[model samples]
Target chain A: MRDASRAASGRKVCLLTGAAGILGATFCRRWRHEYDICAVYRGGRLQVPTQEEWFIDPLSPHAALRENDNPVFAVKSNLREPAEVQRVVDLALARFGRIDLVVNAAVHVDRDRLTSLASSSDLLDETFAVNATLPIQLAAIVCRQFWQHSRQDNQAWGRNVINLSSMASLGVVAGVGLSAYSASKAALNMLTAHLAAELAPIGVRANVLAPTSFPQLVPTSLVADTVVDLDRSDLTGCIVQLDENGLRETPSAPSALHF
Target chain B: MTMPEPRTLQAVNDLQPLLQARRWRWRATPFPHIVAENVFVPDVQEELARDFRTLYDQRTTAGYNTQHDFLGTSLISTQCGSLEVFISPAWYALFTRLFGINEPGFLTAGVHRHRPGSRNGFPHNDIFPERLDVGPGRGDVLRFGGPVAGKSVRAVAILYYLNNGPWAPGDGGETSLYWDWKDGVDTPVDSVPPRDNTLFAFSCNPHSYHSFRTNRKRRDSVISFVYRGVDDYVQLWGDEGLRQYAEYGRHHA
Candidate 1:
């Protein structure tokens, strides 16, 4: 239920999860235009940023486009906590009033052996909680905001959600030690597909940025590429790739000879 | 701890007349490629011919696939008689010429070893990804491409074939260069076949896509070396960091 008014006006609002990490920071710094950004990260830990601080400044890359002079709010709250995700959503809605693009790049890694034949029983539990559950929780919060905004202002734009997936999710992990990490990423990919399907009518888009691991380990190049790719997706479900950070945002016309 | 004999270099120089007549390494201006006919010395070739049994045994003993890529491929190594091996000063000068790093910030003069296989190696890139702190220009478009920050980097690869060995016709194990794609088989400029001790050298990058057509015969090995990061220009190939991307392909090779 996009607010016909905003859609007609063409003002796009965006939000990004995991704003502090290396990749998130890239989004916070590089992608600053095309839409109003609401850069979201679990940064504050205990104290979430106030509405003006978190939603308006938006931690996105371009400082000039910020609502105020320096529009960036580092809100620290875990997506694993449903309530926390909701709170941030509420603040974002209250401040600038909409979230058009959501890049959910936050993920927790397990240092232990996941595919270890001798591991403990809690492997599945921990993996799902961080990777799958966190995205779900964030989605619940965003969807709620989508509905609430539609009801309140009667406005919306084609909002998108991009989740960071992993290479291990597709095939076996190369390193025998990366089983738990790999399985969790795989689960995250499926979650992204499921949410994209359910959150369509609201003019909200959900997608995944499945990236391969480079020696750097963090991903800003990947997210930046996804932003470029998402511009073209017309259907309800889309799974884009962040090939070595060469993501783009073109609509449906096969992209140029990307590296 | 023995030093590689210096006469091996003379043997390579002597073969240059016949090699130049082949007119290899005559294609590209910046990164031209070719297979030098002579890869190893007589002594090195002999060592390579007899090294596989030891190499294969090492793999099973380690309980891993860390073994070699093929069956009968042999090996040859060279050293300047120093344990602390590094790039040569001359190659460093080459990096300064190739990349616009201006300053002599790179280390050159490196070498490597290669062992050919009876099978084709997967298509891959040799460079590693580096981190750059990107800043948005104007609105929100962070155009990322080329050099970032102050870290200038350059990598030069030299492959010295230790064994020319014999090759059957249509064995198809030639190094293929992919200039761009067409219909299906990427348009190739060069596809050097495996011959006796041969040498290959080139700069590496996204545009430098290369792979062996096929190695469906005896194994092969090359003595390889790299002179890397001798300049300021670095590559931001932008292959995103997604391991299992849904639509886009793998990033690092």
Candidate 2:
């Protein structure tokens, strides 16, 4: 609703992750014009059909929802793969000229906290993947490809990494079987801070979405709304949330969710 | 470097009459948009899940958050069934024409078997984003969702099935999509009869009223899903998954 065209102009193309998700989907829809969108997501998962069925993007689920007549190639692959990650960056550059904004909208949910001894492996793997490892990997890859490491640590401009971390990364929702899950998110918070400090010098911003949905689940689309604001706000290293008022909200607690 | 596939919008355009009929009710909406569509694909694999009973074993007053409807856990699990009742390539193809593209989907789906004799959910638009970008006079999407009374353009509720049998007329598992009351008038919308492995959708927003009757006779089962266009993708893609997955996020130690 707010006019951000002035701020949006002259920015380099954007590179997005988790494009098929509710948050990712919403982001692509609302912010497609703000930047030349380069959306990504996990590939080849069998999506249960909805009306969304007709628009499957062959590359990734997020890419499947684009409305532009412009050709959006679905680079079918996973973010976990370093080689695959590198390939995605290359694809973006080949399509556009350069990448400006990097939004980490990708997330994997693991819910077996008080899981049985028999299910501990599942719990551990899920926790690690959802909690810490993926974000770390994403940051590493983005830094290698996009960051201008030679810039002053404090005064970098026009570059940022909007990571999709969670409120779980900060506090407790008190759900059953959530010990590992909670611990993992908490670790993500620390990772965000570390990455933010390290990435600051490279003229890149790193922020997280530490939402406080105590008795309920917040939508990924809500998080995407925050990313759309990047064109206007000085929200570098900030984590935004979709609050009760149907608008993007700031974290009640100081530390946001993603790096 | 690798090339990615072009993303396309899956506009649910086969729904002209069904949608148009409802749109006839509103003169204020510039244009109405179908924000969600989930069809039950029949002839697919099926299962019977007892997770709902397990979840509700000791937890009563089942409403969990801001959008609580009834007082009990409303959940269930359905096993494999036919794809005939679920969506087919034909329906999907129709969606393509509406959306102007071909979007691929899969054959696997689960079921929501509400607890036996459970009360229906309180009336609400299924997808509510924490932040809606809609404003006055843009269209119907900005005006949809909530218990009632606010301006909402959402007009249909689509329910698909897990099996190939007809639900008894008295199964009590009807859906309510619209309801209203005032000093001078009162109207309510309700769910159509239950069917096995089939997809039935309708509107219940602003003017298209509807609701689901309680399931008191036989078990109430549904292979639930929803859809939206590229315009409303964020609301669906962003917030819709939490309907089930996020609950798993909140478990006690």
Candidate 3:
């Protein structure tokens, strides 16, 4: 860690996953001025402005991620492991002293249809683990931390968790082979709703931004602007779709059919 | 003011054979519905479109609440001069001849406007079997309890599109006929584009599920529902009609 004392300097912190991805990098660049960002990347290095200090392994004793005067702190950690996930939260708190926002942008897509059955059980499990389960786990940890920290400080500010989702969650896109991808995204949407309901009393809002299409990919600036819009609004438990037309709130998922 | 013009009368007459030919095909589908183009004379269509636009602008300026959820668009109930055409005897005769009804009781009529980003209406039947007692002076509503409920009566729903301009081919806002509700196989079996001067109609049965796609552009239409019995008045207007009648009672007394 560079300096725990430096982290105490007041600045709203944003913990962004998949910071190396297109959307994630764009968000970091645009939001760096307004927020102290803890950019967590798993695979490659992100080219955003960052502090000189780097923490190789979050689990190790010497692993102390710190944010100096620089607005971004790049922490490389595998989010699949529970220990590593917890470490990212710890690093954010230790570096920035507070996490005001968490953007779960990491997604895994497996293009296998139910009819083909070519996707192995292991692949399906990994897909769900990365796409849905890990995000939920990260959200639970952040919510708990916010609750504990607010109780300690006796002050509550608006906190937010924006889950990057796709329209595949609503239904299977034609010829997209989205059996696993759709199921996982649908699970993420449900998770977002549950989080919104559970965390409302604590001033933490959760929502999903699902884009309708990725033709040439959705503009990163649009996604960033939507995130800022959702963060500033009181809207929660909503799955807003970003398309060429504009943003629209999708209807809630139907209740399960009982036999 | 008077009966429909000769050309408008002829237009109504021309619709009978086309509707008859498709009656069996529409009824055989999961939901019963028919879409007919050129339902009105060109001049009459232009007049209705102009009146609809004027009324829509006036109502929207007066701050009418948008019904984006169930009705699939914003509605304006205030009558306009163009609506007189629907109440004309020629219209009644056309409906009577087309559907083979002895006497058609006009339930209600209204105009609706759907702007962009206002799509995705869940599938639903227009009439239900539930009854609402509207106290004294107001009649009770007897909902359509499907075919099996011997006490139930049928109603006809008609939607006349007035989107009098060119639209993109893939642009949505088409009226969709579905087999069932949201949770069922939601793929629409038939989708009727909101083309100018086109009309879509169906009998309000249990399986007569219909909804509209979100309007990619502006779409305007006039909807009229007709039933065989006066009981449907309560179904169409609901509590608002009762309230109006109560106000009338207060004023007259």
Candidate 4:
């Protein structure tokens, strides 16, 4: 739930999941001033700077905003449960008045890659619940809210959903233990595509950003930048892959002209 | 091995008028790509088609997927007398100018012969990130050795259909470009028919995804690659992007 004391009027509302994760945290810190962030982190609250190295800078991106007036509403919720998802949505709406952007950045990675598929069914199930299914459910609820609050004034602002996926989902990035993670992300890609097509008439946009997440290979900031760019652009139902080769639209359409 | 005859260069020069007249259709969707038809004069096209068999001694089976197979060989490795027309300076300039490749790179050409039932080529950009490690002077039966890392990045890929044989839409073997991938190769968004005197080419990048399906007829085309420096690719994609390519190439190479 948002801290009622903070004043974040006029700014767009961003419901960001995986708020504590590397990508999520970076996004929050970088864009704190731009949007009224509803930062959703499960497991625990955002930890202060400690002895251990953290994925994001100890000073949250919203620290300046925090010193003056807080715009980030940190919420803790396990999105797998329907009630929790609804509670978060309801809380966000009550606090921020409206939600303009949804960034489903939370993910479940199966660390135990050695286990066989038959034995790791539980892990696979959990992976799908968090990575793939939750995004669909949350988007459905959010879109319903948008439809209910349809006004020509707010419609012009346009709502957007950006789902963070991995390069593994394309099956081009091969690794032994990535089957479950890959499958779930692939499902997310298809769902987002369908959602984009279906929601286009309603002035809502949905897109998937599949970036190579190896920190050493592709920087985390590049991924964040791509997401922001995707949000700013009119591209919907597009699965944009960012890597060493830069941004490329998957299943790229060939352009040839013949006289 | 026989050296290419001087007249082949002359023939390539004579096609300049037709090449200039060609209206290339370019598109940035999916990725940067271009296509132009009626690329060659009829006489030159017929002559190249008739001599296609001379470019190879014996075609070798190649391709990744089990369901797909085709006979392919490097024309330069064969040193056929007619190979000069493709590797000639005029031809090389046309490719570089069309693709806007600024760097100096070697031009290598190969022929892929796909027969009926040997359909469905896998989608790939033809840039092998792992090939950069293989040092020069290790020229194989497929390609000539160039400077270090020059053999690694394929800057551009151009396919000129040599068979000048009658072709139709249903005949298949159209080099298809895709918009996305599913379990296997999904239906291509656009397909270039393997028609005579037609030229299909694109700048080889990570997003230049393309494949082909050979359904009924024997599909034959001279596939040429412009091998640029690793630095050029690195400059565009960054070191990490190259590393990612290398990593992906390790698993799939």
Write down the lDDT of every candidate, Cα atoms only: 0.47, 0.45, 0.63, 0.67
Give residue B120's lDDT in candidate 1 (0 to 100). 47
lDDT of 2 by residue, B144-182 (tens): 122222222222343444332456756666553343321
Compose the digit string of candidate 3's lDDT tens values, residues A69-182.
254788878898669999999999898777877888887877765655565586578788988888878888876775544632312344678898887788767775677888
Clashes in candidate 4: how many? 6
What is the Cα-based lDDT of residue A145 in candidate 2? Answer: 60
TM-score of chain A of each: 0.71, 0.70, 0.80, 0.81
Candidate 3 — what's its lDDT? 0.63
Highest DockQ scorer? 2
User: What does candidate 3's lDDT look like per residue over B51-85, in tens digits?
Assistant: 77777666644333343432222231345665555
- Candidate 3 positional error at A81, Å: 2.5
lDDT for each residue of candidate 1 in B16-128, tens digit (9 for 90 to 100): 22222232222352134433454334544455444433454443322212222433221212222221111333333322343322443333222222333434443433444
Clashing pairs in 4: A29-A61, A244-B241, A251-B178, A251-B179, A251-B180, A252-B30
RMSD of each: 21.3, 21.1, 25.1, 20.1
Candidate 2 structure quality by residue, lDDT tens digits, A11-108: 45677777776666666666665566776767422122221222332112234343433323344457666577788888877877666667776666
What docking class should model 4 receive? incorrect
Docking class of 3: incorrect
Q: Given the true complex, what DockQ would model 4 score?
A: 0.01
Fnat of every candidate, listed in order: 0.00, 0.00, 0.00, 0.00
In the range A164-185, model 1's lDDT, one tens digit per residue, is: 7676677886655667767877
lDDT of 3 at B226: 55
The residue ranges of model 1 lying beyond 4 angstroms of the native Cα positions read A1-11, A33-35, A43-70, A115-122, A148-156, A214-219, A244-259, B1-253
After best superposition, candidate 2 residue A75: deviation in angstroms? 3.1
